[model samples]
Structure formats: C-alpha cells, structure tokens
Target: MKSILRLAAATVCAFTLLALQAVTAQQVQIEGSVNLTPFEARGITLSTLYKVDGEFAGKQGIAVPAPFTLAAPRRDGQQILAQAKPAGGGPIKIYFATDDPQKRIFSSLQIIPFTMKTDDPQKRLEIGDYFAIDLLKKLGENRTTRVNLRRQVTVGGLPAAEVVGNFVNAEGDQLLVRLVAVAKPGSPHGIIGIAVGHPRQGRIKKVEDIYDTSASLAFDTVTFN
Candidate 1:
C-alpha cells in the first residue's frame, strides 16, 4: 500500500510538470543561442532573452526564425541612456521571467573580463565597428545570431547599413554586445547607445523562416569611429 501511494505521488508530480511545460510552450519558443560577447565588448550584458516563437516567428506570411530577446535595465528595459556596469565579482545567471509583462529584466553580477587583459579590468577593446568580429568568432561557436536580412532606416536618417551583432553574457547574465556607430548629421563622430536585450521585433519581417532579424538591447554602447 505504501509503494502504491509513492507511485501515485510521482505520477501526479510528473503531470504537473508536463502541464507547466505545455503552458510555457504556448508562449515564446526557445531558439538557438547567440553570443552576446561582441556587445559585451561595448560594456553591455544581456539580462534576459525574450522572443516571438511558433507562428509569430513565422511572421504573418513572411519567413523568419525567432529572435532572442534581451535583458532590461535595472528593471526597465530600453534604457538607452544607462551606463555600462562592471561585474563587481560573482557569478551571473540567465533565465526567463514572464511575469514582468515589461521587457525582460535580468539580474546578475556585472561581468568581468574573460581574461585579465588589463589592470583596470573594464577595458578590453575600444568601441567601434569590426572590432567585435574576432570576439564574435571566438564566442559564437555553435550559435547563430540574428543579423540584418536587409538594410533599413538608421537613426542618422540615412539608409540602413548593416547593423549586426549577437547577444552574449560572460561570467554571468551580463549582456555582451558590439554595435556599429551611427553618425549624427554627417558628423565624423557620433555617440551610439548599446545595451543587451533581445530583438524587439516591432514590425520586423523575416527571411526563409530561418531567423528573425533583430536589434540588440541588453547593453549601452557607443562607437568611436
């Protein structure tokens, strides 16, 4: 009789787990991982990943794979003006929090440098385009990041150039990022905002149902070029 009770309990537990999984499956579908290190090069750590899954990834009649959603600021995402914080010292972890309704909010220690490249620990590479390619190659070993399917309008009001990158977090749940610069009004220099968050996908379209093209949001970054 005792054995029968234990078996019944196990079956009930399994059923609860499966029920939760079914509910979550109806929400966002988890896709492949993308490296946020490039963005991290810019000093942003991804807090969380949220993306449209299933038919949403199908995108109406357009083709696109799901895009990774990124972490939110302190608790508010889309904080374009926040400065990058360094990992004080600890481990960072990543997970999903759907209860927030707001953009993905992530909590983790600021990430330290992967290697002790400098005494400051904050400086790795300067902010600029093409700077993260090497880092991306190093980190993106089995990850397929979302990139530009086609050019769109840039902040500078010019035609969309190839603004691309991946979402990565090192030691913890930090947002790793590398973004291109957007010049202001033909100025030779401009400040670009960088942060770690998944693609917003407001009205974005996809190609071949392979991946949803998205912009990074987990960190704040600016290019010096």
Candidate 2:
C-alpha cells in the first residue's frame, strides 16, 4: 500500500510539471534589451536611397515588393507611392507615404538576411526588434522621450513584437512611433514594419487608436511571398 501511494503521488507531480512547462512555452519570449541608446550609437541611417520606384499599384495604389507585401493607407489628399532604398548590403528597404508634412504619417518595410552566427529564431527576433526601433527613430527624426508599449505580437502568421513610444523631433514637435518585428522559424530573413505620426493631443487613447489603425494596417496586411 505504501508503494502504491508513492506512485500515485509521483503521477500527480509529473502531470503538474508538464502543465507548467506547456504554459511557459506558450508565452512570448523577448531575448534582448528594449533600450534604444545602444542602437542609436551605432549610427545606422536609412536616409540614402539606391532605388526609387514611383509606380504604386493595388489597394490605395501602394504595394510593397517581394519577401512581403504591405498595403498602407493613403492620407492628406495625396497619391501614395512606394519607395525603395538600399540598406547597405542588406535587403532593400521599401516604404510608402506622401510628402505632405502636415499629415506626418508613413510606413516602411525592411527585410534583413540572417547571419549564421545569429540564426536562431529567438536571436533573429531580438535583432529584428531593435532594427524596428531604429527605423522608427530615424523616420521620426526624433529623440525618444518615453516608451509606452513593448509587447509580443503576431504579424503575417509569424511571431513578432510591437514597440510604441513618444518622441520629440528637432523642432520640438511631439511624435508617436510604432514598430513591429517579425521572424519566421527556419527562414533566413526577418522583417520589420514601422509607422510614425504626429499626434495633436498625445493622449494614451489617441495614441492607441492611431497606432491600432495605421501601425496595425502596415503589419497586419503583410503577405509573405
């Protein structure tokens, strides 16, 4: 009877351990610092464009090129266009926007090829997340004031992360920035989508609404090719 009781107790313990392990596996894991200073110090810039294509086709007349397709919303009574630029030796960076400074909203897509030394999915995600933040900083041309959101998300059926924050541009104009980083297991590249805007009120609800619509559209509509 003693041996039988011990076996039953062990069985319950084993099941409990398995349940805990399953829960942990389901949680999103972020493997790197969320700070932006280190990345900024690297002096990465997306300013120069090696290629420019004015032809925008499909919904709202703006479509991003291969590896992924992003359909960004049009604003400010202007025709939206997708622009392409080289990211040094990395994959080309493609973006969509109008030149209306008053509207102050744009979205961009970038694909970064993975190196053998950092090929793990988690590692790729970490790098992708930082890259997304860097894109936001450069696009806004602002210094980050505060980070409001940093959480796990899914984009295009792939594991991803979203970072939203407040920034101040050179002229002291407040801005809102949102970025999503996505990585597919076993794939050789990670993708990042960035959205930037200038908020009139800067309220939390306003920020959420703008990001939920604009930033969400930038990443949620992604189609992998």
**Highest-scoring model, TM-score:** 2
Whole-model lDDT for model 1 versus the true structure? 0.27
lDDT at position 83, candidate 2: 29
Per-residue lDDT tens digits for candidate 1, residues 100-187, read 3442432211111121112221121222122223323333332644443223334323321223444334322213333333332333
Candidate 1 similarity to native, TM-score: 0.27
Q: What tens-digit string does per-residue lDDT give for candidate 2 at 71-164?
A: 4444333323332333222233333333554322343333333222245566556655555555444543344456778877777677777888
Name the runs in model 2 displaced over 4 angstroms: 1-66, 74-78, 86-116, 133-144, 200-205, 213-215
Worst 10 residues of 2 by lDDT: 15-24
Residue 192, model 2: lDDT of 57
TM-scores for candidates 1 onward, in order: 0.27, 0.52
Clashes of 1: 40
Q: For candidate 2, list the clashing residue pairs, or say none.
A: none
